[model samples]
Target: MAIISIANLLASYKSPESKDMWERICKSIGSQMENLPTLEGMRKIVTLSYNHLHYYLKGCIMYLSIFPEDYIITKKRLLKRWIAEGLVAEIRGLTLMEAAEAYYNELLSRNMIARADDPKWTVETCQVHDMVLEVMVSKSLEANFVSLVGGSYEGMSYGSIRRLSIHGGEVVSEGSRSNKIATSHGRKNDIQVMNMEHVRSLSMFGPEDNMKMLDRLGELRLLRVLDLE
Candidate 1:
């Protein structure tokens, strides 16, 4: 599946030099496959593909990290969020929405996102491959592009978060359920606090009971997107 996706991406490149670069990338991946585990080797391919994406497209793809695994993302919602986050810019004569749509199509052409099955046979939603999402999440963390709470990132500490995504049963433990928490990992020092003033987007994916989490929404003053599911 990784190879097929890489091949599809390569097919989308019209330049001979681009084709050669991808061909060499494929060979390098093949050489390392012998020494790496199956999942690791596939991650290598996806990581390479991600690194080779256009700068803007890379940002667009990294935004997908906000979504939980196997979450069906709607085209309209994703595009609108991109525009709201200023990740999408008008290109040539294209309007912002058109430009965003073009980015969506490019991602599809590269097989970075898979179309979700719809009973109406419409391509309105898509799902990110697990391996692909792994790479995205890794990159997002490395850049501090997003600070995720709950799920695998529970209890993690970050500095001046730019975008926040919460995935768990509750926003935070009742003891520290207020807007701020200790920034130091495993430390109760209140002097250093987790800052959300810079957070531009907040996505929450959990139960309706978690709605109380919004009471502290004032913390994310710069928030532009509030996705709840």
Candidate 2:
């Protein structure tokens, strides 16, 4: 005859377990849904759809992994690869490239993928929210995911990792600033000070020093939307 308050019950649940549930449910909605995070009440702008976004976005993005991490992706190249990977369906007159581009653009409009820092999406970066990354990493780790890094930053020592995300900083050396990227591959790419315009909402409240690395941090190209950021 013991009853626990709903709030108390949720509070008692482990942080890792709660986070894992969020990842699974969100992903079933949309691959980009994993890019969105709920952290300390902070919010972000990203794509959300009730349709078969999971299948569409997942196929579209995972196909792009043919390129390396931090590799600048262009619209044409993405479409070409998707077509080659059979990500695009064969429509009568619409070439596979066209279908793929349309799919990419749709995801972009919803903020699923960002427009590159430059035109042509050639230099475009694929970023997801940090909370999403945490959830992604947690999910992978729960499933024994382990990621590989090429930099010099000292990587995390945690075992039973199911996935890993890499960014700008390299393996740390004796407490150096390196491994910043590898340390938190599960993060949102909050942008700031783009020559005075396009400041990300996360930047509004973040301390200047804390924000220093947003621009410099690298991207996890090998991971698909499944890893969020």
Top TM-score: which candidate number?
A: 1
Instruction: Evaluate model 2: give its lDDT.
Output: 0.39
lDDT by residue (tens digit), candidate 1, 1-229: 7778778767767686786877787687777687775877888888878877888999999999888777888899899999999999778899999999999998898888888987764659988998898778777877889777765456676777788787665444445412222222332212125666788888888665255457667777787888776
Compute each candidate's TM-score over C-alphas: 0.83, 0.39
Candidate 1, residue 202: CA error in Å? 0.9
Tens-digit lDDT string for candidate 2 (98-142)? 777778866655443555565545454554333323333333333
Which segments of candidate 2 are over 4 A away from where they belong? 1-54, 62-71, 119-148, 152-169, 172-229
TM-score of candidate 2 on Cα atoms, chains taken together: 0.39
Residue 157 of model 2: what lDDT? Answer: 44
Q: Candidate 1 clashing pairs? A: none
Alpha-carbon local distance difference test for all models: 0.76, 0.39
